[model samples]
Structure formats: structure tokens, C-alpha cells
Target: MFGDTIAAISTAWGNSGIAIVRLSGPDAWAIAQRQVRLQTGAPLKPRFARNAVLLDEAGEVIDHILVLPFRAPHSYTGEDLVELHCHGGSLAAQRCLELLISGGARMALPGEYTRRAFENGRLDLSQAEAVGALIQARSNEALRAANRTLDGELTRAVGEIYEELTALGAEIEVGLDFPEEDVPYIADESLADRLEVVRQSLADLLERCSSGVILREGIRVAIVGRPNAGKSSLLNALLKESRAIVTAIPGTTRDVIEAVLTYRGIPLRLVDTAGITENYHDEVEAIGVERARAAMKEADVCVWVIDGSEPLHQEDVDRVHELADTPHLVVLNKADLPQQISEASLTALIPASTVISVSAAEGLRLDELKESLVGLVSGTGALDTGLNASSRQVEELRGAIASVGTGLKALGDGLDQALVSGCVGDARRSLSRILGGDRDEDLLHEIFGRFCIGK
Candidate 1:
């Protein structure tokens, strides 16, 4: 769609079997032909890889490579595209990119290729965002969720709701245009019922917000408790490695030890914080305790680790009490030893929390702990829908839902048809923004700026 050409190293910059230097735009094919010297002396063919020698602007050899070309409208970016498959490493790819740029192709900006795809009608705005999501996905579930969006699942879902709102707006507009009739085009009850359905549909999409985000971004779990309570041991057991130092000494963990566990295709970022207690052995220990509390406050769930082998101390009671209003799981740790604490006492303190007995040192029932953590964050639906709306998309859906609610209220109160129609129009505009139809240049830049160059 653009008059100029753009180039970049499509592959990651590192030593590998091959590195791709890509070019796109009107002059892509011409630039490739000028820089590539086919070994077979054959004409450059579209969709065929030809052995070639790449040359710089001064007529110097840069690298021996394969020249692959794609014609306009069929290639990515919907422009003539060329890929120079050169030897892997920073040198060849870098040199090839330099030559292409010198040959008149400008350096592609971060996510420029995908941005061009959006501009050329190859993908919608949500699909463009999905390309970045798929690139940054950290788990299998995240990948699947991103894939669904790239495949237009999100656009389709929003499209249905958008259509319903548009139809409602048209119905309301009929009465507004025929003010002389002084009669409603549709029954107020029927209009209210249809608007309610639209509101419910928007709410349903909004409901997927938490699960989608948790799937894409993962859940943060902070493991905290009194020192010598096997907090480090629990982290180690979950990660199946000695990621944190474990000892019988209290306040041994003087900092937050963080690691990640991918449980059931969802990432659980586990933070093992220093023990929490009023009694500190040193200034460092006190600081550690402060950090421990901070981690618990920030985490999606606090896995409160309590030593079951020891009698209930005031510290244990205080820590458990703190979790009363927080989303947390109580682990009565050291279960392999003779128990001195009863689950009843802790449950009575925090009647709503889940109490699981586990022996971290012996790796007892860690699977159950993981399962519980997954269930706590996974919500009560199948994650297969792959509708992971970003915070921006979620906010838009909320706005649309609010607008629909306003329209419903206006209709119920027998307000002017014009006002109700305006509400429907507002809802449609909000939904349109989600698909990039009504987005501005700055918003598009902010969204695509997060992408890596050559994407």
C-alpha cells in the first residue's frame, strides 16, 4: 500500500542455522533483484528459492544466500515481499539488512510488517494485536488464546454483539425520524428485552476478562509464613528444584525468591518471600519481612505456609488472621511429622480459606496444592474459547455494556427516542473501537510499538 520499501532482519539476532532479511512494499522485488546475484544465472522467480550471492552498495559480496520472492497482494503486507535467507549470525543478517537499506529500503519499525498487514486489509485491529500476543505468549494456553484472536474469534464475537446493537439503534431511529406519528415503532417492553439481551451478551464477554487475562498473563502466588515454617521448602517442592536456599534457621531467606511454574498450561509466578514476624534477627530480616508482606499484598493468591508440626504460635495466629480478607490458601506444612495443629483451629480463624495439609520436604500432595491454585484462578469455564481480551478491550466492553444499560433505562422511563438512539450509537462506537475501526493514530502506535522490529 505504501510507495516506499522497508527492510529488517526477520529472525532473532543470534547464531542459528539461518537468518532472514525481509523487505516489503512496492520496490521490494526490484530491490531484491538489484542486490541478489543468482548462482544459476536464472531469472528471479516468485515463490521459488534461488541460490544467490548478496552484494552491498559498493558492489562487494555480503553473503552467499537464497533469494526467495513473493509478488504483490499475495505476500505478507499485501505488497511485493523478498526474503534473503542468509547464514545465521549477527554478521550476515546485519550486513544483508544494511545492503537492503542502502539499496533504498527504509528500516522497518517495530511491528511495521504486521501494521502494514492491518492497513492492507489482511487483518483487523484485534488480529493485529493478536500477532503481538502470539509472539509474546509464555505458555501453551497463552499461545492457544492468542491464536484464537489471530484467527478472528474475538472480532467475530464482538461482531455479533455489534450487529445486535446496530439493529436496536435502527429500530429506535425509525421512531425518531417519524416524530409526527407520536407512536413507538417497537413496543417498549420488546425494546427493553432486546436491549437486555445485548447487555447480557456484553456482560458475558466481560465475564471472560479474568480468565483470559490469567491465561495470557498468568497468576502470581506468594508463598509466605513465619520463618522456619518450610516456606522455601514449599517453593522448592513446587518448582521441583532447589531454587531457594532451605534450612532450619529462621530468617534464612533474606530476600524474595521468585520462580515460575507452568501448571496445566497456566503460568503461576511463585514468589517465596522472607518470613513475616515482629521479631527480627537483624535489619536485613526486618526488611525481608516487609518485602514478604508486600508480595502477599500484590499476589493473586497468598499460599500461607504454616508448620503443622509446631504448636500454634501467636505469629501463626496473626499471619492466618491477616489472610481473612485476602484471597489465600492455607498450607498446614510438615504433615509428614506428627501434627500439633488441627485444621479446625485455622479454619475457625479464617473460615472461608482452603486448608490443605502437605509435607514440603517429602513432596506430599503438592499436586493437590497446584490443582487448587489453578482452580482458584481458572474461573468456572472452559478456557478453549480463546477470547483473551486485553485490559483495553475489556474496558471497551464495559463501556459498551454501560451504554446499552443507559439505553435500556431511557426506554423504560419513556424518555425521548432520540436519546435512546444516541445510547445505541454510543455502544456501537465503543464496540467499533475494539476492532480498530474507530481507533486513532496514536492508539495504533501505542499498540504496535510493543512489538519487536521485523514482526
Candidate 2:
């Protein structure tokens, strides 16, 4: 499938100024030349853009375009590549792609371009995955994280430890094979120390994996409270827009109203759930209340808004009690009004959770609340060393850490040298797999499957 020249509309299809039709593989230039002719009738130059006239099979004009050619071994897929800069709309690019396909270029599969780049030694597995992350990033932080990985920051870090493990494994193998030879075996203490260092490195990467995943996939925050508790007001205040319907009447928002915003470069999906109350106005209110509960359970953090101006209700205390095991915050809203419920009292009820007083109507002390929300994501403070790790990478790191630990234990216990050598080999293989050393066809398909076509 990779041997066949592949073509795809790389740019978005719309009535814009320009769209890109991309082709890559051995016959990419030939396929594009068959569909387009340079205005000056000169041969296309490598790494240079030339004005071209796109023509149909009958030699009739299709569209005026700019053709950019790239020679093999320097292109994205390390193959001959061509890009047609055509007028942005459905018709022109579609016709150009059809012509290229008819000229022996097959339509590219989803993520096939990036997959080829990975297979052709242009990019490692992690970097290739980052290309997909870059496209799907929801916030600046996510984009930066993806950019770091794509820039080979992750590959460099993993490569350092992988090389170290490889050297250590070699030394251990020599010791095991030449036990009776004059070559001195590495002292058990020295081996333990070296293994400890590698284990620590893997553990640090493992620690950062949670926040890295959150950076790629943003957090979901649910705003939950009883009726007339300024739940919708808090959502609107955080969003800086009246996204949810706000009114003096209770239960104005009868369903979940969600909005996404960037808070300190973090993508936050805020869900304003309907007021939780058993005293329903109708079946709709009951359904809304149920959905609010579901949202609370699914959220990364739940902001339990309490009206500070009003005395505490049974529902408030009951909800607070239920959040004992969940990660939540106590937000006492209506701070602009004369206070009736003290922060001290709310703190006493939920001592583990942070209590912040804010007027969602007046937008008071919300920054502190936002900071608390950001805190819910673990290991976000460390981003300098390529914090982002895909689920597969995370699992591999864990396995490597475990293997290192097992090797250290074997050395300490004075067990067979073969066991220690086997553990070291296992750890090295795990790290290698992360850098795309052992090719697993099924794993490749699953990872690239998430990407959209033409990437």
C-alpha cells in the first residue's frame, strides 16, 4: 500500500483563498505532472514553486495552481512529494485530486502520510503521534506540549536513558558470559547504583505522565449546586459571557450548558449543570437533576456552589457529605451580598476541600477559584522535560521502571546473574519499543487510527 503514490487534500475544504492537494511516493512527481503543466512549459524544479495550469484528461483547463515539488529523501515521507496550491473551494481541489488519482495516485488513508514518515525513518513513534496531537490541541498549553514532543524533545530524553540501559546491559552480559575470565565483573554495589539512577529517571517520567495526558486531553469541570445557588452565574462569570440563561427564577437552566475556555493556558470544559433538587417543577427538572449528578460523577473536579447570603439548606449539607471521597471545591457564591454563611462553617463541613468566596454575579475572587481548578490536574508544574506521554508510552515507561526495580532486587539478593541480565534486557526492550524500535503492526494501526485523513 505504501509503494503506491498517495494523494490527499491536505488543506481544509472551503470557499477560502487557497487549498493544498498533497501527493507523496515514488511516482508523486509523475502523477502531478500528468495533471498539471507549468505555465512556461519548463520542467518542475525541486524545492521550488512554479505557476501551473491544471488540465483534465481531455487537455481542457481545470484550475490555475501553484505547484511545489520536493525531491526524494528530503520530503516529509522521504519520498517524492508535490503540493498543488489551488483555489480554496470544494470544486477545484476535488477535481485536481480526482485527476491525480486517475493518473495512478491513490487516495491517501487517514494518517497514512505521517505513518509513512514514521516507517521511512523521518520521525519516531512519539514524534509521529505528536503530529496528531498538534492538530487536535484545544489550547495553547496543549499545542506547546505537542510542539515539544514533535521537536524531538521526547526522543532525546528517552534516547539518553535507552543508551545508558544498553551500555549497562552489555556490561552485565559480559560479566555473565565471562564469569571465569580475567575481565573483572562489575561490583554488585556499582550495578545497584546504576540501576537506581535509571529507575529514578523512569519514575520521574512516569510521574509526569498524568499531567501530560491532561495537557493533551483537557479537563472537565462540573459546576453543581441546588436551585437558585448561582450555578449558572458562576459558569457565565468564568466564561465572561452569558452562555447559560440567568434569571431570578430558580431552575432557569433546566439542562447542562457547557462551554470551553482557556484558563492560564489550560483548556477547561466547564459544565453548568441543572440545579440539584428533589422538589421538581416537572419531569424535565427531575431529568435535569439526574444529569447534573451524572456530570458531577464524570467530572475531574466538582465546584459545589453555595449561596453565602442564605442560610445552609439540608441539600447543601447532604451534597457536601457525599463529596467526601470526590475531588471538589467549596465555592460560596453571592459574596457581594451580606453574608450569612461563614467560610469557617463551610470549611468545617468539608475540611479537605478548598473554600473560596466569590460573587459570580460580580466576578469576585474567581482567579483563586481558577487556580484551584488548575491544581486538580497532577504534575502540571513540570513541563520542561517533554512531559507529554501517550497511554502506550506511559505503560512502557511503567514496565521499564518495573523491570529496573526487578533487576535491582535481583542484584541485591545475590540471585543468578542471568535473572539480572534478563531484567536489564526487558527494561531496554521496553524503552526501545517506545522509540519505535520493535515494530508492532497492530500498535501502529491503533495509534495512527486516531488521526484524520491527509495528515
lDDT tens per residue, model 1, 5-53: 9999999989999999999999998888888888987788889999999
The numbered model that scores best in TM-score is 1
How many pairs in model 1 have backbone atoms within 3 A of each other, for residues 3 or more apart or on separate chains, i.e. clashes? 0
TM-score of model number 1: 0.92
**CA-lDDT, candidates in order:** 0.87, 0.87
RMSD of candidate 1 to true structure, Å: 2.3
Worst 10 residues of 1 by lDDT: 379-388
Model 2 C-alpha lDDT per residue in residues 1-455, reported as the tens digit of each score: 36789999998768889989999999999888888879996788899999988999899998999999999789998889999999989899999999999999899989999999998899999899889988987767778878888898778878999989888888878887788664437778888999999999888777666566777766799999989899999999998998998998999988999899877666788999999988998999999999999999999989999999999887898888899788888899999999999999888877877889999988899999988887866534564333567878989999999999999888888887678888988998998888899989999999888888888
Q: What is the C-alpha RMSD of each candidate to the true structure, in Å?
A: 2.3, 2.9
TM-score of each: 0.92, 0.89
